[model samples]
Target: MKFLFIAPRFHNNQYYWVKSLTDHNHEVRFWVWRKEPLENYSALTPSLIPRSSFGLPKILSCYREMKALDPDIVVVRDPRSFLFVFVSMLIARMQKRKVFIYSQTPLYQTMSWVKKITVRLMLRFFGSLWITPIIGDMRYPKFHPRAFYVPFAIEPQAQEKSPVRRPIRIISVGKIYQERKNHLLLLEAFYDSLKKSDIRLTIIGALSGNSPEYFNKMRVYIKKYDLEQTVEIKTNLEHNEVLREYAKHDLFVLPSSNEPLAYSPLEAMGAGLPVICSDTNGFRWYVKDGENGYIFKSEDVSDLKDKVSLAIPRLQEMSKNSLNSVKQFYTPKSFYEKFMEAVQSV
Candidate 1:
């Protein structure tokens, strides 16, 4: 089957999916809104339509491209790409083909009425929906059957046995979103629990330019609490650099709340690092508590500290379990099989 995927950007996880599907004898093409400089995704050579160039010309270009490809299925991966997907859906309908929405957006009851109406109309006319299974209490009232659970896949890396560091290196990766990622919470927990111990906490990711105030606040907190030495903040590392960082770390921590199946933890698992995350995160579904990883209460510093302290002593066993779990459940081949089944059913 020929599948055309439209996304805001071609991420490493999406690249794995494209490679997996093509390897399985399916023709896969991609159209990305923009390309990130740090991402190593030139292998696919996806067609690019810059986000700034989203006008009538781009819309017509997308329509013409879809008509030319005449794909068996069109998969839209970004909710923000509604105009592009709508064009693809129109072309698909005219060709008697199918369109599917692969979304990470949670359809919670508290969602705005406008978004609810928009989703309803899309499901009514576009095609079936595939969403992460871990979205919390979020349901499409009228499109439950059309929605299928599709987990993200990771390319596993070969395990390298290394001596564990005495300082118990821990790493967290995410944008510096003050309220959403809750990095401050993780910092507080780390400072309260592991400060005296010989442990190092590194928070790595891009600092959102839009949230400079929050970023500055974090810096101030790091200084005021004298966590300057204990905690390190690294920003804007390349994709390969991130993997190297993950390799050096003993544990992965994500203290974010309301996440819809984050890919970083899965990548960490692929690198054989045990995960410590908030229970509210959607990806917590993959974590078998006390087995591969531990889930702490969201925003609860005491509980997070307790879970971190408990997991510190058993990192080796948990790390092994983490590697084995990803190998068993999160491979690209497994994801491809499931994706094929879902597409066929649709």
Candidate 2:
């Protein structure tokens, strides 16, 4: 089947999906709306209307492009977002083309009234618009009937032998978002729980997040608490290098609240690292408590600390479980098969 994706950027796990589909001889094409200078996939050309452009030009330009490609399915990244999604949906509605909303799990509870009305209207225009959520949470469909699970797949790189790294390195990989990632919570948990213990935290942040103050606060806490040597901060490393850092770590902890979907924990599990994430992570379903990892309360320093402390001793056992879960649950084949099923099942 020929598939055309309208997304913000063509970087990250989008690479793996594109590669997988093309390898299977499925004609795949994408139109991106932003610039990713890190790696140029030349075919991932910019849309006629750049994301920065506003008003009718954005809609017309995207609609024209959608009409031109005329793929079997139009995959809009999200239904809630501006620009691309509305335009794509408009074109799909006009052209009578099938739309598979490539999406994160919808947080229906916290949605604003305007957004709720907009999303419902979009769904109304196209009856039973299939939603392919990256987060594999079945509860989502209970909230919205059309949501179907199409989890993000990554190439597994489980360490051959679980090497016991000393000082117990813990890594938190995400863009620095004060309102989003909750890096401060992770830091506080580290200081309160394992300050005197032989454990180290390595925070690797992604670029493009507008939260410099949050990053600065982390430094202040480290200095004020005299945790200069105990905490390490690195930012904007290459994708492969980030994967390498995963191998050097003992556990993955995501202390964020209301995270839509985080790919880092999946990648960490793929690398055979156990996870300790907050309850609010949209992808928490993947982290099996006491098996692969434990889930703590969101923003609860005490619970976070307790989970971390509990995770320290069972790292080796949980590492194996994480790898096993990745093999069974998160494979390239599974992703492709489910994607095909989602499109064809209708």
Candidate 3:
């Protein structure tokens, strides 16, 4: 099948999926906002409409390019990209081609009221919606019957083995969003638990827009509590560098108060590291208490500390279980097969 993946950027996940589909003998093309500076993939080209140009010109150009492709299926990456997806749907509808959307969040729960209203409006036009199976009880089909839950696929290379390092290093990977990611919560929990124990946490990700201010505040808390050596903060690294970080860490910690799908936890599991995540709907999908990893109450310092203490002793066992869980549940083949079944069923 000829597939056109329309996304904002050709980053790690986008590149992984497009490459996976193509390797499976499917003709895959991309309509993306920017070309990744580091890698060269001849299959992808500049999107017809730059994401910056917000007007009728962008819409018509995207529509024309999509129509020209005449793809069998066009998958839009997220709800924010729905405008372009809407245009693709219009053109695809005229050509009788199928349109699908990949949504990672619950509409009513995650977005602001205004954004929710807009999402509902655009959702009415989409043929189908895809989300991760772990999205606990967000009530996806409350309005649109076409919505389905399909987990994201990790790169095959992400599943490889890495030599374990000592000193019990814990890493958190993803965008650093205050209140949302709850990095402060992670630090507090880790600090409290390590009063007698020995463990270190590395906060690695691109800080949010207000991260500099947040980081300064966190530093105050760290110094006041004397957790300077307990927690370290850093920004985003290159893809391979992040992977190397993953390989070194003994466990993955995501103390997010509110997350839609929580991609970092999945990637951590894929890399054979156990996880301790917030008890949010998305993280609950895989972090089954004693199964793969453990879950803690969101923003509850005591609860998080207890879980972290429990996790440290069983790192090796939990890491193996986490890898097993990803292999059994979140494999690339499973992701593509289930998604393809849903697409073809439409």
Question: What CA root-mean-square deviation does each model show from the true structure?
Answer: 3.6, 3.3, 4.3
| TM-score of model 2 (CA atoms) | 0.87
Poorly placed runs, candidate 3 (over 4 Å): 33-48, 51-57, 78-82, 105-146, 155-166, 208-211
Task: Write model 3 residue lDDT over 213-270, tens digit each, in one string.
Answer: 7767777888888877777777756666776677778889888876766667877888
Ranking by TM-score: 2, 1, 3
Q: After superposition, how far is residue 232 of candidate 1 from its true place, in Å?
A: 1.8
- Once fitted onto the true fold, the runs of candidate 1 whose alpha carbons sit more than 4 angstroms away are 50-57, 78-81, 105-124, 128-143, 160-163
Q: What TM-score would you give candidate 1 relative to the actual structure?
A: 0.86
Greater TM-score among 1 and 3 belongs to: 1
Write down the lDDT of every candidate, Cα atoms only.
0.76, 0.74, 0.68
lDDT for each residue of candidate 2 in 144-176, tens digit (9 for 90 to 100): 556566767777774543666778889999876
Score every model by TM-score: 0.86, 0.87, 0.81
Q: Which of candidates 1 and 2 reaches a greater lDDT? A: 1
State the displacement of the C-alpha of residue 55, model 3, in Å, after optimal TM-score superposition: 5.1
On TM-score, the candidate that comes out on top is 2
Write the residue-wise lDDT of candidate 1 on 1-346 in tens digits.
Answer: 8988877778776767888887878888888766765665644778775333335325555666777888888887745555655555676676777778887754333556786677777777766665543434445442345666566777777774365868889999887745678888888888764558889889887765676877787899999989888888988788778878888899899999977667789889989888988877888878989988899998898999899888888899898898888788888876877777777786
